[model samples]
Target: MSTTNQFQQAAHYARVIAAIARDRPVPPATLSSLHVIANQLDNAANFLDTDAPGPLSSLPIAATEALWLAELFAEDNPATRLPTDFTNYVLHRITGRPLPFPEPMFPLSDRLALQEVELTNRLQYLHDDTDMQVAHPDEWLRAVLSLWQKLLRLAEAVREDNSRSSHQ
Candidate 1:
C-alpha cells in the first residue's frame, strides 16, 4: 500500500479513537470500514512475512488479534462495546492504569480536537520512520507489528473491562 493510503488510514483510526474518547455513538459504517482496514493490514503483514504462517507467527498475530477485537467491538449491542479511552479512564481512576492521553476536562469539541491532533502527530512520527522500514524488511515488519500491538493493547484493555463488568 502507498504511504498516502497509510496516512489516511492513520487519520481514520484517529477519528475512530476520538469518537470513542468523546463517547459519541460510532456509526455501524465506521466500524465496518475499520474492520476492512484492519483486514488489509493483516493481509499486508501476511504477504511480507510468509515463512512463519501459523498460530505462533509474530506480526500476523498482532494483526489477527486486532482484527478479532474489531469484530467484537462491532457487535450490534453498542452498550456492550467498550471504548478504550473510557476504559483507560476507568482503569486509571480505579485500577491505576495510567492515562496516556490528556485529561478529558475540556468541552467535547475541544477534547476531540486535541485527541485528533495528538493521535495524528504520533502516527506521523510512525509514518516518517517508515523510510527506514523501506530499506529493511525486518524494520517494516517491526513497525507494522508495533502499531498493531499498541492498538491491540487498547482493545484488549477495553475487552477485559467489559468482561469484568459483565460478571458483576
Candidate 2:
C-alpha cells in the first residue's frame, strides 16, 4: 500500500469510528479497550518505515476489526462504552492534532470552531444512543479494506504532487 493509500485508509477508519460513536451508548470499559487498540494502531503506523514489514499495512484493519468485535460483545456487556476522552485521544494520536470537538467543514479556518462543534455532536450521539452494535462484522471489515485502498491512492497522489511542486 502506498503512503496516500495508507492515509486514505486511516481517514476512512476515522470517519467510520466517528459515525459508530454517534448516537451510541459506549461504556467506559469498552472505551478504554478501544483506546488501547487505537494506541496499538498508532504505534504500528509509526513503525512502517522500518526494516520490518511494518504494522501500517494492517493496523487500520485490525483496529476496525477490534471495534466490530467489541460491538458484538457489547450485546451482553453494555458496559463496553468508549468515553469522549478516549475518542478524542485516538483522533489526536492518529491525526497528530487534537480531535476536533465539532468537526470542521472542508476549507476550514485557522480556528477549529467548526471541528469542535462536529465532534461535540458526535460525542453527544454516542453517549445517548442505545443501539450501537454492528450487525455484520464482515461488512465492517470490508469497508475498512476499501478505506485502506483509498489511503494508498491518496498517499501516492500526495507524493506525486509534492514531487511535481518541488521540480517547478
Candidate 3:
C-alpha cells in the first residue's frame, strides 16, 4: 500500500476509536490514550502528506492494533480485517490460543462508544467508592491496549520483512 494509504488506515483506526469513545463515556486512561492516538494520527497525516523527511515507520505503530483486534472481537465488522500474520500476533497478545482464520470487524459505533463511556463511569465510581469499590478493569483496559499495540508490531514487522526479503 502507498504511504498515503497507510496514513489513511491510521485515520480509519482513529475513527473506530472515536466511535468507541462516543459509546458511553471514555475512561480518563482510555480517553487519554485515544486522544493521543487521534492527535498523533492527525499530525502524522499532515506531515506525511507534505512529504516530510521522517521515515514512514512512525505513523503505523499506533494504528495497527485495533484493526487486528477487530478480527478477533468484532469479527462481523466489515470495516477492519487483520492480515494473517498480524492476526496471529494479535491472538498471541490477547489470548494464548491460536486463531484459525481472519475475521472481519463488525461495525458497532454506538455500542462501542457507549461501552467506553460506561467503563469510564464505572471506573470512576470504582475509584471513588471506598466502601463498595471493586477491582479496576485492568484486563478490560489491557485488551484495548493490546489491540492498539497490534499496529506497532505490524509496522515494525513490515520494515523487518522488507529488509529480510530484499537480501535475496
Question: Across residues 63-135, which tens digit of lDDT does each residue of candidate 1 receive?
Answer: 3454344445534333323333322221222224443332222222444445445544564565456465345
Best by TM-score: 1
What is candidate 3's local distance difference test score?
0.38
- For candidate 3, the per-residue lDDT at 117 reads 51
Model 3: per-residue Cα lDDT at residue 68: 39
Per lDDT, the best of the predicted structures is: 2
Q: What are the TM-scores, per candidate, against the unseen true structure?
A: 0.25, 0.24, 0.25
lDDT for model 1:
0.39
Give the higher-lDDT candidate: 1 or 2. Answer: 2
CA lDDT of every candidate: 0.39, 0.40, 0.38
Better of 1 and 3 by TM-score: 1
For model 3, residues 58-132, the per-residue Cα lDDT tens digits are 433333344433333333321232233323322232233442221322223444444445444453443344243
Indicate the worst ten consecutive residues by lDDT in candidate 3. 99-108
Best-to-worst order by TM-score is 1, 3, 2
Least lDDT summed over 10 consecutive residues: which range in candidate 1?
Answer: 86-95
> Per the 3 Å backbone cut-off, how many clashing residue pairs does candidate 1 have?
0
